[model samples]
Target: MTNVERFLNQVRQSSLGMKRLVVVAPHDEATLLAVEHARKELSIDAVLVGEEEKIVAAAELAGVCLMPYDVVATYGDSAAADCAVRLIAEGKGQVLMKGLIDTSILLKALLKKEYDLRTGRLLSHVALLLPPQGHGYYLLTDAGMNISPSLYDKQQIIENAVDIAHALGNDNPNVALLCAKEKAYDKMPATLDAVELQALNLAGDITGCTVSGPLQLDLAVSAQAAMMKGCKDPVAGNVDIFVAPTIEVGNVFGKALKYMGGYVYAGVVVGAKIPVVLVSRADSEQEKLLSIAMACVCTTSIPMEAGRMMPEMESA
Candidate 1:
């Protein structure tokens, strides 16, 4: 699979008339700069919603021209979020991004039943980590949403991450159910959950990806770690997605990678009618721009499941 830089280049080089992005409360410097990069690099049309004066000033600070965008005047973040989501529901925008507003406020507007964005699937966060020394990107899921997802929630999370993998040009992604050890103990619920998820994939209850479970983080990403342990797991070294047992795990690990391990990342909310770019306020401009590119790439096409590896998922 291609790395983050390569994948972003592919998105940049795609045909014009890219997906339209609607940003709520777009008055922040980083957000404005990132969207400006998207506008110039990917040809994404933008709809900026917020206090028009503030948005214009911030865009100027970021050296971004707002002339090409539809800047909607709104009173506050709450109103901006509502207005942006309404525009999306009206087909004026193809993607929604959070900007200079609380994510909860944005999500509240998005989840309103009247908006019709829900597909009856759980919304989860997937972050694409671009390790400074790696050849490809690593995906970490449910990091920003779902505090402690149930087994069923994990299923949907995996499905969402798989969709992202497909968007990144990997038709069949390898998933690693990350755990503390390489074995399941009855007392460890995460280990047990891993076992069941792996079984589901093996039995075809999950489709479109290869799943392996109860693997420690090292083994999941390092071929040498698997070799040192005398393990011959197919997904051990080449896992595309790392399924964190809990939100804390994913969140802390991703931050550690960025702050301590020198990795850049892009995060988005999935399982909506369209992909949602939701980067942190502290994220660098590059991270925010990459998130926009990631969301746009995901708008391409859906991955269809053929005869599943686990044929029984067809009936399940």
Candidate 2:
């Protein structure tokens, strides 16, 4: 089994206590089906927030039963967002989810004062892709958030990925700052920031991970490519997270890997009070189950030391 499946199996064997997940827009068919499976099969507890009739309708369409869980019975996506956030803050749930609702609505609710879930850190989305051909899984960041990030934001972005890597059980994740070019060119801002991130890792400003930078996609994954580039570092060609220069770059590259390479994908919003799962609408039920499993794996690693996500997760 994959590390994710193992985690889900663990969740299956004994929940210790069922963890609560506040699913916003739970009325959506895909969202409801995923939640129901997570609850019944994986030992997760959920509070569904959406229009009551629509939620029930979606469940019926999906051929899944949703009546067992608490339904918040809210109207409209905005109202569902409000209820989901309130559920989290009221200690009714530990995690948040997005459904058919706009991500902005859920994010706005999460960032609100009453929720008290913010850690004063920018929340970024990280996708874990287990591309079928490759043995190593990869971390794709900001695919759902941070449209255009600056150097400072990239630092936080790396921090978020590092945290995720640790949560997934890597002791010290190796991170690569990805750019089109492989070296820091003073004129190219991406390369420059990559160099800066490298410096931070070297100077100990960034901990729990080995940071290397100005690496092209090849150098981030292929050791032969790193050797060909004459790059010398433990992180060369073996990075846990690839920090893309922009969300466009990350999004495009990630989709390329998924569509062209047929990757099994899962994602979670990081730097939040708890892991927030968001699956692709086009993903399969197995993919959605894998996403929830990945979230549970990350959640279980919360008490461990940071930077433990490298090497622990391999393909099924």
The root-mean-square deviation over C-alpha atoms between each candidate and the true structure, in angstroms, is: 5.9, 5.6
Model 2, CA-based lDDT: 0.75
Candidate 2 residue lDDT tens string, 1-316 = 6645654565455442557778887666788888887776677788888888888899889997766888878888777888888887787887788788777667777767666766645677788887575255778887767777878788878888888787666779989888888777987899999999899889999889999888888878889988987877788868888888877888888888878977777778766566777765798887787677666655554331222111111111
Root-mean-square deviation of Cα positions for candidate 1 versus the true structure, in angstroms: 5.9
Which lDDT tens digits does candidate 1 get at residues 1-316?
4465676787676543658999998887888888888888778899999999999889888888788889899998889988999998898988898888887788778777777766656778889899887478888997778787888889988998998888777889999999997888987899999999999999998888999999999999889989999989899988999999988899898889988998988888877777789766677877888888888877664332222111000000
How displaced is residue 83 in candidate 2, in Å? 1.5
Regions of model 1 farther than 4 Å from truth: 1-4, 13-16, 301-316
Error of 2 at 315 (Å): 27
State residue 153's C-alpha deviation in candidate 2, in Å: 0.4
